[model samples]
Target: MANAIWHQWVGCEYRVLKTAKENIVSQRSASPVLSSYARLQRFILTALLCWTVFTPGAVQASEELHYALTVNVNFGQDLGQPLGSLFEVRDSQGEVVLGAGFASVYNTMLQGNRHELQLYLHGDRDEALEISSLPRPSPAMGTFITAYNGELLANAMNYGSPMVWDSASTTWREDTTAPRYYQTPVASGNLVFRPSQVEYQGRTIFASERTTALFFYGAGNLFAWEEGESDLSKAKVHAVPWTPDRDRADMDHAATLELATSSAFPYCYGVLDNEVLMVSNLGWLYGFDGEQWRLIQDNSGNVFQMYTMLNVYDRLLLGNFPTGGIYAWDGNTLEFVSAPLDYAHSGMFEAQTFALYGGDLYVGMWPWGELWRYSVLDNEWNLAARLFSHPERDSDLLTPYRSLLRTEFPSREYSSHSLGQRVYSLLPLSGSLYASTSARSGRDGRDIFHFLSQQELDQYGAVHRITAPTEASAQIRWTGEPTTFVLEVHSDSLRILQDGVE
Candidate 1:
């Protein structure tokens, strides 16, 4: 009953079959689109009327089973729309936990211990959520925190030099105190921490967005890229020891060693097959085995310029920037899975974000806000859900909840704005999928979350049962498009095989 919370009047039944047929005939003769739609409707009627005989409880069981159909209606006036909730934080127990606009979420173990869920707020005051409680997220602590690695590592971003977080003193201080006296070079400006990182032993390796530097912090040593690049031709990776007394100018720069210079900056890094893989925004993939750097040759060039990587089901999946589709690396090579490569019309065929839930891989599509699911057995991407519903885009009817949003706030500046038209982030938590939207037109976006029901997961047919207006004389009003209705009955009455025989 996951999708039970979201439903509308999906189907209708009628007794005036004679009047309905007459209206269909008149509408079909007027428009070609209607002609096509009528033909499809006829096919559905043929199958329904043929099944005149039914068991005693067959009709009653249909009601309980929610035997509804999806009718391809191009135009329909708004009926009494069912309502749902706005953006509200809910916990594992389906309780309202917190209410705030969160932009990003990261699930990690704080220092390989305390389980924590980090939430980045939407406002500009540099705030985040620290939830030490796992599974059930409640009583979250809102603190002025920066990039963290357990009780170690230093304050990142604008909080100053890589200072360690003092759990005892509850302050951001120099790393020369007790426990571990670790020192890392001063990080450059505008440093944004990526959610993915490689943490082993005492060393924590993470990359940044704008800088061509890879941060390395471990065992009293901090190796980070200098504020400025030494060489513009190649990407620079360096390390420095943590010395509390020594000044920046007094430190020796000769200890810095370059990892790779082929690419200027390493924007993305993750574990692919247990090895640390680094990719540059300029199109190059490298693998480091704690010793030498191996260039993972991507002959197809699909792995180049990837922004996101997820190792799922023993497969290294890569999501591209703005041109390429989702690709998987099979140890030796990478292959294309699915893409809307008609760039002129489809825009950029890239996945903005991804989530894995219920044995299905859901990817948040870019430019279109399409939520597509990848089935492991089927090995295909199916349209599971959408953030926005436009008649020109999808043939499915808008959920009553979504229709309410469209009708109430149809413009940009409205208080209750649209869920934009693009999904920037997706998080599957507590058996529900939460999505954050992005506005392509530089407008404000909204956050909405929902769960999919069983019926939505297994949609076998598109049903339409149009009833003619009461008795007197009815005229059916239809459009140009053919309304094709397909019925998926669980009977061996008809079968169309490969040879075109029924």
Candidate 2:
């Protein structure tokens, strides 16, 4: 009876006895033939349904994710006002972020030498993340010096003590014993230390106070202390005294050069092409072959103090202090290209500074607190922006006359402040501008500011929040009947079925 019922269901319009015999034969050939066939059909149907519902587009919508970040600059020192702010991000979004409020951590009127502040970024629903802190130093410690090595930012307190801030970790650690510190003193008393010249031949050669002899520090060598002193000394001066390969010995012999003066007191030295150029405070230019330092010129004759010098475009560019002017030195002569507005000297007062950005030179006259941009190509000058301004009158009383601007030519249009209350450095990071300012007195008064790009700032209705995706219901699914029946029925049969008269 069961076999008859199965045959009737399988072969509804065909020969029932023939179908029953075929089914019995298939059952004998394979175990549970009917049940397995039904199961496979159901699986295929379910798979088809799943494929239709979860297409590539649907899968992408579910897996998307976003990470948010907010950067804060706290002034650890004594600054009159907040310098600026910037938003930095490390995520898949690949865009610069911005903060919502201007959080003030110090009151300048109180005149407190020590102040501490924290920069906070509000995430979704006012959830705050403290990005960094600014700590005020003791009065005796003086100002701090910071250095940026592409990925890591390092600062030295009181000249030799080093501290490193990791952008990835958003934390600060003391690096007082960093390996880069050689016996070379970068600063002394009131004088700032500048590298007059640097020579690299598998080692670094720099001129410092201690030795008239050329000092060589090997590549990848850490800072080591001398036998009995609290300070370190030069590791190696002459070429590798001994080498296993005779070829390397010959190469070193050919590569070595002798300096003209046993005393390395020259204020400026740099390499150009295969030749090296050195400039002295008394206005002399010296060139060095692989053999000796030959005198190039007795005097530069330009009426400016050489504060910074660079070899650019096969020409030697010199930055002058007191009179903020730029001079170009060809192999034979020095010519003045342009000067800052009012011929303002960087040494005139505190807070006066300048930097090179995008092949143009920028000068900041402090107390006046105005920014001037010099176009090297056009040989013209324009006011880029006003950082701080005092009324034309009474500028003397309020101006510090000792502002500092330390940066290489900036490729991007953003800026940042250092430890001083003024903008210490202005540069771009990840499509946004960061400004860092320092206070004169405390560990907690340093402030870092961020400015976002125009496109990102425009996206927000009020420039405080970001747009996020909302969840929604699943899309509808469709099922279809077999196509064999459609082919069997004609247009008239289909119309009859539609009319409900089948």
Candidate 3:
């Protein structure tokens, strides 16, 4: 048998109800929050995913069926996580693959930076391979890195300019020998390269200048320069105004837009049908063709600032900022669907990014810096932290600027110390989902070091990884009456049931 891992979340009471050759059940007690946990244990953990990533190469030798594994868990009432002890999951060589219990209620790293959420599929391959694409926004991933055309590409956050990871060595080589991607009238500061550019027709598109303007990357820059825009880099394949390719572009058929709103930044972009839908922070939706632009919906004054755009479920789902909800756009009509960011007393936030994995939609939430999973099979949204280890914020979690960051990070809405939090980017790399974050507060800016503290900085940037806890640390005290927990594995898939109720 191949080595396997199982993550059992917090639940009530325990006992081994059945044990047989075909069916084996394991029981453990649930513990309370760590001794230092401040939430008072009001919120117990719900569901967790099971894995199918192990022994992918060994299974399906006949291309029909070869193996199946099932593990069941039962818990007693009032199970708690009060051990307040730190532990690790180590490999045979003694390297810790996972560590948690840094002042947590569940002692699980559910509140940390990254997690490899299990996809329960019993097959010869990993299910993460099914995820095709995801938004790679620059905000969440302070130094977000991506891959394109088989080469590793990274942003300009650490390096002054865009960088490419040397497949040969540990060093990163500058993509453009020039110091920058753009040569401005003076200087364009530092441009965070959003590698996820959407391609339409022959034009590949991304936004810059605060997304107030859209830049097209193509063979020729067939557009007239917007008066204030800058020029492109030395490798001028990207078609934009004021670039070398401008000479090859037709001045008459220039790609220019006459948007309905005044100076609105395109914070969100989604591909619906064949049209690229651009939604501004102020709720103005527009559809763009190679030559023509059409205003889709004008919610300009409605204050429905949408931050994230996802083309999923045959529709464009816009993450509304103020309402902390989602707006569904089916090309013909656009309306509010549901508020899945059901965090503490909510006011305004940025539902920043979205990714699809294991037949579910996962959202990168902001101001609280959390990730939520929406299950299509259950028709419900569940707070599933597929990655990270921070203490769950209290229900009344709010900040100074209406609990939101300044519209601009350097904006003078609040002091420079509190820039707010974000799950920033839910990027799909290789065959798995990788995430990055924009923490609520930290030493982000070089000069603003004095504004932050060591405690805040410590919480900001630790890379956390979690695995199934060892049996020694699995036992806990009681918290409630007995419920149910079940794990069923077949030759094709794995299924889990919590609260012992199936």
TM-score of each: 0.37, 0.37, 0.50
Tell me which of candidates 1 and 2 scores higher on lDDT.
Answer: 1
Candidate 1, poorest ten consecutive residues by summed lDDT: 51-60
The TM-score obtained by model 1 is 0.37
Clashes of 3: 35
**Candidate 1 residue runs with Cα over 4 Å from true position:** 1-263, 298-304, 322-324, 340-347, 389-421, 440-502
Q: Write the per-residue lDDT of candidate 3 for residues 1-502, one digit (tens) a residue.
A: 0012222223222222222222211111211111111111222222222211111111111121212222222322111111111222233443222222111100000111111112222111211222112223222124434333223344533335556555356455667633222211101121122232322223433333423223222112322112222333111111233232222224344555544434444555554444556665456777655546687778845776766655433466767676667777777788878767555225656566665443345676766556676654345667766333333454455532333334435556445326455665454322245555544543355334334445443333322211111110111111233323332222232332333322
lDDT of 1 by residue, 196-284 (tens): 33222234443335353344332224334433445654445443343322233112532443444443555444443334455555557
Give the alpha-carbon lDDT of every model: 0.32, 0.27, 0.37
lDDT (Cα, tens digit) per residue for candidate 2, span 309-367: 44333455555544556666666667876665544553432322333222234444333
Badly placed stretches (over 4 Å) of model 2 are 1-149, 157-160, 168-171, 176-264, 297-304, 345-359, 363-371, 375-379, 383-502
lDDT of 3: 0.37
Q: What is the Cα root-mean-square deviation between model 2 and the actual structure?
A: 27.5
